[model samples]
Target: MNQAPRQRMTAQARRQQLLTVAWQLVRQEGSAALTLGRVAEEAGVSKPVVYEHFTTRQGLLAALYKDFDSRQNALIDAAMAAAGDRLQDKAAVVASSYVNCVLTQGREIPDVLSSLDSTPELAAVKRQYQLDFIEKFRSWFAPFVAPSDIPLATMWGMLGAADAISNAVVAGDISQQEGMQELSALIITTIARCG
Candidate 1:
């Protein structure tokens, strides 16, 4: 009944491993349980290993958010490229991809997001990501609607709706089909109104 020795991993691989373990921890025990030491313990590495990657809890939280955002961006980019040139097709892709990304990550993201907003520094990081996402959305839909016609407020509103509807889907308040349909309609109508 001897335990096997741990295999060596490159620093980059180790960081990815730690992040994956950290996400699993958050999924099971919630974001409050996601301290660097906890991640180190769960990842079967020294605390310094986790510290080397994310020096602080805020740092770890920000990294988690960035990881999630990166995956979401990749999904949207791939789907958008495959989507038809029509506005409705683009809108549907956006809606389905956004919701599907959230659903794919399951319900843990909202907790991670709330944790990110707990501190001003982390909140700023989160806000910057949100702003970037809105800009990306604007650029994607700009072909259909004049950029100026959409207004910053409308973009923010659409983002809000996306977050709300996606969260509802994750929370089981609505079916995946219902959420995607409603979100797709919202995007199309919002762009139509702005145009």
Candidate 2:
């Protein structure tokens, strides 16, 4: 006879738990290893349960992106708010928070970004958030650098670089200090517009 099912999990809680486990597995290994099979195995749930939670790998990836996007955006928002009406300080705050969110949150963020990086479909999902980041940056970065001076392109480049470095550090290919230097260089280039 089948064993009694484990205590039923509320849908929201179950989804959160699945995401928690999915990201953990990705953090430990890589996003490529974050399949329904692995998540089910890690979460102590069946594959069907994972399927019910996420429906597809894309869905799962999208949710993961959403989860971290919320976090990153909040940090950016708080920095902007705390910087008050001062323009230069706002960018500094935002840059510090964005960099810290990537460098400090470490693997959890890198995993989510990696999983969604290659999925062009997710660009549409990410675009809205990108716009929000830009608008916030624009207001903050506009004073010191002309609206035109802010390295919008380089801003994105910095984000990609930070994500890659985080993954590298987790995999032991790069030192955390190395990651910080590289990321700091990107930030400096974006802010200073170095050629």
Candidate 3:
């Protein structure tokens, strides 16, 4: 039997390929099984190549998270752009986009997120992403709740609810439709109270 020769990829393309394989490894074997050497082997690349892109396991984990965050942000932004100005429409988009993003990523994200909290540095990275997300929520809903700024605590509370409900949806504890309906109502109610 003859093996096909591997095709050369650009540096950026190779990094993307490695990230894709890393996510696959996490999805198939959980985040605990993710490692540079394992990703290299799975991608049919040498360990050096993986190391070059992600200097350490922590670096790789961070990249994986950032990749997920980037996708989530894009999805939300696009949905928001298409959403009507009504509070109900915006809230629905937020709930749907968030739940759909997590569902699309499957169960691997929670594991990756747990791994990200294992170290201080990774925790900071995750925290920053959370803070950024909260800011986004503030900006999106602030217009509806204008004349009164949404309290930071309120924003945090909303984020907490979103995470919990989305996790429940992903875990099959609640159906996606149920999660979205609950989340949308919570958002509208929260903003209404603030207003």
RMSD of each: 2.1, 4.7, 2.0
Local accuracy of candidate 1 as per-residue lDDT tens digits, 1-195? 999996799989998999999999989999988899999999888999999999999999999999999999999999999999998999999999999999999988999999988999999999999999999999999988775557899999999999999999999999999999999999999999888
Q: List the residue pairs that clash in candidate 3.
A: none
- Clashing residue pairs for model 2: none
Q: What's model 3's TM-score?
A: 0.95
Superpose all Cα atoms of candidate 2 onto the true structure and report the RMSD in Å to 1 decimal.
4.7
Candidate 1: 10-residue stretch with minimal lDDT: 142-151
Alpha carbon deviation, residue 185, candidate 3 (Å): 0.7
Model 3: how far residue 147 lies from native, Å? 1.7
Writing each residue's lDDT as its tens digit, candidate 2 over 1-195 gives 999887888999999999889778877887888788889999998999999978888888888888887788888677677775543455456545665666655677655665666778776667766677666655565665664565567657655665566667766787766665665555545666632
Candidate 3, 1-195: lDDT as tens digits? 998996789999999999999999999999989999999999998999999999999999999999999999999999999999999999999999999999999998999999999999999999999999999889998888788899999998998898889999999999999999999999999999999
Q: Please, what is the whole-model Cα lDDT of each candidate in the order they appear? A: 0.94, 0.71, 0.95
Worst 10-residue lDDT window, candidate 3: 139-148
Better TM-score candidate (1, 2): 1
